[model samples]
Target: MDGNKALIAYETKGGATEEAAQKIAEILRSKYQLEVDLVDLKEQKMPDLSQYRNLVIGGGVRAGRVYDKVLKFLENDLSGKRVAFFVSSAQAGTPGSYEKAKIKFVENTLAKYPKINPVATEAFGGRIKILGKTVTDNRDMVKVEAWAEELGKKFTQ
Candidate 1:
């Protein structure tokens, strides 16, 4: 509650965003020994930011749109906090589309919240669904772990 604690708040469409949040929490807890909380944007309200030392916020993208709740959270006062933002989308994991996805996410989300300067930001590949059928999953654990690890290091520094 006081030190080495982080909150990972996220919104999901088909659970990809939630999965990414959980993976980040797991990596932080296991590798960095940090206490991480995974919050579902739809099910729970935002906790007091003053309680945590760091924050990680993410959302899933659908049809080039991000969840409104994720954007709202970014509107908060995040100065003097270590923060990171990420997005999960089908295009994010594609070979040539990842850069575009990152640009789109930053332009749409991060650009709107210029006050919230994240130490690290990324766009991860998410699962694709067609008519409720799983088409593709591009979530990479290696990437997730590395990002999470870097987040921990930022806090320690």
Candidate 2:
């Protein structure tokens, strides 16, 4: 594995998760000087994991469930890699339900995968649109960037 390389793999429905992945990739590359690769899970079901030492996986929540693609990806053997996980959900964005959303979508979900111990995990706000018009948008790019910065430090260590 290349210690200097990182992979930001994500699956999105309304684009919030993809945006978060991009922001994370930007911070890891520009601030940490880490070589980062962004992959959309929808396009690539399986990416060659042998080349990266750090892996960041992200997904979106819909109908109260994390994206299936991400869950499926998690089934892969991730041993010896610095893994991080994140999810984008409307509940996560709302101040009242953020903790619950984190528990349900991040904590509880990861609990099922006992073999994959992530170095960091987070739940970010999501956007909902109708007819090409945004109806609800709670995404915070600043928060995403901050998380990325922290992840960069961890990845390097």
Candidate 3:
């Protein structure tokens, strides 16, 4: 268990975060031929950080913060690691109230892990709308998958 592997974990409330995680995993796999593992915060217990060399985390932005599980998981043992984080927010391009909230979420999360050398950390745009048995305005997982592939390029440099 050397610290050279890549791990991607996520907590998605309405499946958006999971979609982003899958995209990131595919990107790393297809571009760099890297073996990335996806850990669902809800389904699995937290894994030891020392077991991997690289780590990526993503979760849903709810109310004004990352999902509770993601917050708790990354709070511990994030020092001296190559890490990246992302949140799936309902707000994509507009710097509105939700956007600021997302930024705060990132800020607070990063505050806990000051030593993380993240090459990239940003919120994936769009959201999951659930209202009375209807849905609208979901971000495309395909794009995230492609972006994840592109983001992997960061590791090469």
Q: Candidate 3 lDDT (Cα, whole model)?
A: 0.72
Pick the winner on lDDT between candidates 1 and 3: 1
On lDDT, the candidate that comes out on top is 2
On a 0 to 100 scale, what is the lDDT of residue 54 in model 2? 97
lDDT of 1 by residue, 42-79 (tens): 89977888888789999998878888889888888888
All models, RMSD in angstroms? 1.5, 0.8, 2.8
Clashing pairs in 3: 3-53, 4-53, 5-53, 27-149
Show the colliding residue pairs in model 1.
none
The lDDT values for all models are 0.86, 0.95, 0.72
Taking all chains together, each candidate's TM-score versus the true structure is: 0.93, 0.98, 0.80
- Better model by TM-score: candidate 1 vs candidate 3: 1
Model 2, residue 21: distance off in Å is 0.4
Pitting candidate 2 against candidate 3, the one with the higher lDDT is: 2
Task: Report the Cα lDDT for candidate 2.
Answer: 0.95
- What are the per-residue Cα lDDT tens digits for candidate 3 across 16-92? 78877877887787778777888999998767777776778888876767788888877767665667888887764
Candidate 2: regions farther than 4 A off: none
Model 2: colliding residue pairs: none
